[model samples]
Target chain A: MLFRLTREDWKVILYNLGRMLHLLSFVFLLPLVPALFYRELDTLSYFFFTSGFTLLLATLLSHLCRTDEQMELKHALCLVALAWLAASLLASLPLWLGGACSSPLDACFESLSGFTGTGLTLTVDPDHLARSLHFHRHLLQFLGDGVGIVAVSLAVLGRTEVSSLLAFRGEAREEGIRPSVVRTTRLIFGIALTFFVVGALMFTLAGIYEGADPGTAFFDGICHSFTGYATGGFSPHSQNLMYYHGLIYEVVAMVLAVVGALNFNLHYALLTGRRREVFRDTEVRVFFFTALLLGALTILLLLGKGIYTSTEALFRRGIFQLLSAQTTTGFSTVPPLHLSLVWPLSLLFLLSLAMLLGGCANSTSGGIKSLRVGILLKSLALELKRPFLPRSVVVGERFHHLKDSPLTPPVVRGAALVATSYLLLFAAGTLITMAYGYTAEQSMFETSSALSNVGLSCGLTHPSMPAGLKLTYMVLMWMGRLEVLTVLVLLIALALSFQRRKAE
Target chain B: MKRTLLCLLLCLSLLPCAGATPVSVEDLVRGPQEWDGRTVTVTGEVVGRLERGGHVWLNLLDNGWPLGIWCTKEQAEGIRVVGDYFHIGDRVEATGVFRARCPEHGGEPDLHAENLRVVLEGRRVPRPVNLLLLALSLLLLGAALSAALTLRFRRKEPFLGYSPESF
Candidate 1:
């Protein structure tokens, strides 16, 4: 009750935050290459200014907070929370300056969406955006989702061993593959690189097979691979995957999304020759079963009303949409208007469930995560078994993830708390959207898509959308990306800080 | 006989011409079934092109949203300007069979063009550099570089007693 975070506590937080800014200064400069390539060099000054400004700020903050002190768990938590907001704010500068966004808030929304790997966009007419700016949008996803910003900053630049690892945990990427966080980050980066190389190559071939020139194919291939493996759905074309109009390209995207969403621990097991974890893991089973249920319902709905005539159409439009949502990847073969206007309500609701029950935990995908969902369901089953047991009998169960892990009370409760928080936030976002005169179904669909960090939209997201809704979805994307608790901690810290300020 | 001929002419006038009654791509996307397999006219700026064996795929941008059009190579050859970062694309009107699900190409929603005509020639999009914006950019950039350079060379002089390990 007496807890008060003094300014002294923020010294370490701001210091590490500056370390993150050091990496971000380079991020701002990334778009300049594409600008040069596309001959949009007139806009190059914006990137230079943003990069230089960030570098100066980072230098200043580091000097101000310079001390021979280490961060504790609380400091790490606050740093992770503060870093995302700060990075998004700094990241929006180039986007706004490039004239891609309609307003500052819209650019901020796009920046957060890209930074969180939430593909929702308010960038006005992305189809006409400058080439370098378009590349920056995709690059944001690669840094945030593929190589986690927190993990990379801490692993590469963080000086303190204990606190750096704590920051990794606070970022929800603590499933380490090695003893040291640096080694783990390196291994993860290696895995991501291997996948990116292979995926890009395959996508390029697919694009060529579908009748594209080498230049466009190679360009789209590299960019798609970045967002695809990140499970961060962003595309240069406004039409998303429908721009390709190729079945093969859609297939490649689906495979990449699934690969991105797989549990990293399982990937480690398979690399170490423990191949059985693919089928034996409880989290993996939950993901498949849920996918199967949702996919079947969606496909059945498509076929029931004669949405398409042939198998190819069914696969590209129907199956692709379901898998995209299940992976929490926002790539769509259908237009937003089509999804909102023509798709059956039941199918939209099914897609909502798919988005809400996203891929496995500790993966790039976001939702209540498969492992948590599995634990909650198992706990429910254990309770169901209670009525038949003797009064004194205490039943305990275990589920296999990377190994056999007990369904402990704390684990179940944590899962429940997170799930409850997600649903409540979903409700709040839906209510705000409804208050703006959208239908209940439309509100629910868009809210879940944003809160689950699945970038799919049902015609509710656009540049002309209410700014209030834009702020709401931005906050939702941030909270959902961090799995709520980190943001909640930041909020409580802010409140306590203000209370302390008033008391003084 | 005169009345019958006049009535036929009236009916003919009721139907839309090749360039008339241009259907909205958004409308077709929202209600594909209603327009599926129907002959329709569409007008948009040609933005991108992809060559097939004998045909070419042109992405016609209607107010910044793209609608794919499958046209013969001859039709695509007439397109002199394709839009990108630098220039406005050729504005063209095409009469085609709008497919809700094109079976030939992965069931993608597209139009198979029967006729094409360029209505407007595209030119270089005006990109006037605002002097005010350029000035602000230079000033901010200058300030940033100066700050970075000053801190790098003289931070130790200000805090000479500070330990290097602290950072």
Candidate 2:
């Protein structure tokens, strides 16, 4: 019954399926490094077997369903949605077969964490896991997540101008890349590589200084680099970031996380001495002030609650956690329970707001994003300033650095699409979690964290959480990572195609 | 004499810091074994149906925690599984005295129980039926894969299609 498909649709599906296979094939290399490093051939062999088998199946299926043209916007969205679902399904092979996860849902959640770059983990006793599995998990976040939807959208934008705008505005800001979406993808990858190298070295040195075992230090360094650069808050130790307990490590982590949250195009401009653009960029200015102001407020809250006996600990811990949460990075120097009363609630609110006002467009951080918030705020200000202005003042004519012209309908609609989708996803997660015996504040915090790919949990996230909630969180992660439009498109296409088949 | 006394005092202060135990899961487990009757440690997966009472039984695990843990019903309080390994098959580490099995037990003679301490916990909850169901599901999935492969080959016959076979 599933065999019948239009040649045109088949072409798009097959072409995309081939790319998905290739991507999965590339991910096979992740486990090998750690397997070799830890001298565990059993795990390496398992990885080889599972990845080879999965990729082979993917390729065969794609070949059987070969299509023949450039994908339509609907098809592209369908492709991405299918790609993520298929990837998660296939990726679960390793965890399931290798016995890394006992339940299929748990495997799905962990993979979602990787693909979405939300560093929330369901694994227990991480220190004992096969080195290959741990490395594979981190590598997923490093590669798939680092190469974001915006970058991918731009890469494949090609002649599909409208689709590109839809994708760009739908997922992230369409303002980061210029005329060519493909070129932007390449640039993001290049910059990501640079950050990877620098972040890895710094983290490695810090690990060594902290007197971590040599082998563990190296592994931690790799994991931290990816997590830090992607603004994924995953940590290797059970205690999260508390195990390191070094001021220097915390400072470095904060810096790397902030770097991750910064807009890639802005970074590119600064490197190229396009300093003027940086100053005029509203998203950049807003992200900085929001982070700075929130950081100060958090510090004050901690002081007021008498959480820290010393001012130094107050500033250090406060700033670290604030930036970590704001950047949507889940790295915690201390568990939320240990903090002063005012701090946890304050951090939760600040972090939720940060997630709501995510990093700049074309960056790894998730949430509503700083860019959308900036646009919304600007739109509000314009409405308020309306009475003083002369008639026929077309305010939508505002120029952005990356966009060659003024804000177009597609651009505005795209942003609105993402904004609405994000809120809906958050709402769904919250409603489900609240039903599972959580407070509204706790539910909102967790839902926002999952939707933004921000892994911070206020003692609510647990492995034994209801299966329904885990599945919901997984869907949120997928939606959060892809943003809303792509998943929506996929759903619509699938429904339409099914209806057409039934009519026949 | 004062200089000697100062040195002694400094040494005394530094001694406690130097002798501070490295608090790792492994260390905690080994402690029970070494201490014997005096607060010895046993870190294994919790096993059995944990009772509402303070006492809990655990089936200790050796390595990676993805596997489920078993514990007796007595000591399940305060311990919550945090991941996917929540069956009798899950792996967990527990710290308790190595003692003789309870008279009610039909298993091995040397069973560890009573003063069981949960130093490090994992996400392995005990659900015996669920694990059996998982095994059955995997078996079904394998059968389906095989059937799909067989069907693909059977469809390759010339009578089934208009086109001639090609290598």
Candidate 3:
């Protein structure tokens, strides 16, 4: 029921729109770097020209409107939903115009992947493509992911409303470092930049030490750094992670991926010298524990399938895939489809779970998030424990590091909403994929990958994947990136608006 | 027994010369397009290669089909390119363009130059990060939208806290 929001809610939405417009303009500008480098004047001009016009429009619109108000949860969700659709449409301009992506559907998929941090690609020969195009792909992932709510919360117009902030925390961010939203956003950016810059340097060194071409290696370092920190996992190479065959490189990537998946609040805490807080945070603990357990299971499965006879190979490949998928990074050192069918299937399930859990709140990673998953699990456990407790007991349930957490009702509702949307998207993806004559398992895996914004595939993605399936994946990635609630609100709002029009 | 031993000795004697030529990949490429459907010999620097289904797909500079030479995984062992070089400039020959698609599909010979390669295997000058930064910055600056955000509430109140009439 979003019938009437406080006047302040309008202000919040408008402010966010202004921010989104700015974000979109910056995103469009990302492709130009590679375009200029590859000396593809056509692509370069395309990016520059579109970006200029788009920016001019956004600036004009932003200047024409002004408001100072708080945003409720519903309004915030609506803002997120509209922003996703609008940004995706705008992001497709370069691809749609550039001859590189011929079909509108393919362009949408590329844009969706770029925004959602899903690294899947429909391009046949990424290496042969102009350097600008190649860098544009990664640049999209870099910018779209680098700025999380926490990073930019501080940057948005000042003095957020308390009630709105509380509601926003439940849905939008896992942690707010201060009572003020702007401060939180600033802290987020600071931590993200540190990780990004440092991560890039490390990857570059690792690449050089392993005898990689300095130029390619440097570019790869930047792409991987952004992708890893964002947990987006879009690789520049078509072979994904398989192009590189170095032990240290995989290790470096894994570390960065994990760091990306971790909670930004934890980073803030660590940066502030809260060492004990890092250990005590329940989400961080569950995320790593789940990763380790899954990593072990995956290694065993790979070993059983004879994908790797040696323990060392099994450990290396298994750990990398686990981190990649668990973080929803989607990077892989092996051709995942080439793995034993059973193993890939299992890995897919684990990855799906990870994607569903997502990374920590207020970070670049998409999906439901580990913190929410942890809360859901705790809530479920409490329900089970209720019967054993005395009638007088208050239960006093608490999970660590979460302030103002939801009780059973809200948490259950949130989880169900997320689950329902995810399943629907996955189902839609499968149905469309089946039309392309993809096998059931392949369809399921590919859809799950797209919907989760986890780009692992079972040989189904290609330029030839039916336009319908491609579009479906685009919708899934868009929804996955924003989480389902925002999209659902948008859908419901549209439906209601149409009904009202009919009634009149 | 004597006849069998003599036959084995004759077959063994030819093995050394066979080893010397090493079944050149170049031989596979120049043989014939008619033989394209079958395995032939070709060798060049391994470049712009992608491996799938136990076959390694690569391009030779001289071929025009752009149809990749497909070699079994076993056949591709020990082959390596020194730099970021792939199909564009590597000098090794290839023998596997026999699988080239019919020209009707715009499929010419499987040999196509890759962006990474150059003649004599030299690399094109790489773009510096400053250049990259400038390009990316320019793109970002151009694409940004500065629209004022708008919030339109749903027409019907689905919960107790909100009401359509209140709007």
Best by DockQ: 1
Clashes of each: 0, 50, 50
**Distance (Å) between predicted and true CA of A85, model 1?**
1.2
RMSD, every candidate, angstroms: 4.1, 12.8, 10.8
TM-score of model number 2: 0.72
Model 3 CA deviation exceeding 4 Å by range:
A1-19, A30-42, A63-75, A149-171, A340-344, A388-396, A402-409, A431-436, B1-167
Residue A103 lDDT, candidate 1, scale 0-100:
85
TM-score sort, best first: 1, 3, 2
Worst 10 residues of 3 chain A by lDDT: A149-158
iRMSD, model 2, in Å:
16.9
Task: Please provide, for model 1 over A43-94, each residue's C-alpha lDDT reduced to its tens digit, 9 standing for 90 to 100.
Answer: 7877877887788788778778765678887788889988998888888888
TM-scores vs. true structure, each candidate: 0.93, 0.72, 0.74
lDDT of 1 by residue, B1-167 (tens): 99999999977754445344468777777778889888888888877777778988888888766789999999778899877667788999888898877888767778988778899998987666556766776677677656755664565422222343444
2 versus 3: better DockQ goes to: 3
Off by over 4 Å in 1: A391-394, B1-20, B126-146, B149-167
Q: Please provide, for model 2 over A1-504, each residue's C-alpha lDDT reduced to its tens digit, 9 standing for 90 to 100.
A: 342336577567555555455446546656877777766555654566555665556546645664436655555566666666777776776666656666777877887787788977776555446667777777767665776633353344323455444444444445544566556666777888899889988888886675454555677888888888988877765556654545666777888888898888878887898888877877777788888888778777666765544555665566776677778887876444333223456656766776766776678888877777766666667668878887887555464644434556675676677798888778888889999998777788888888888887766666777888888888888888777767876676677778888998
Best by lDDT: 1
**Which is the winner by DockQ between candidate 1 and candidate 2?**
1
True contacts kept of 1: 0.49
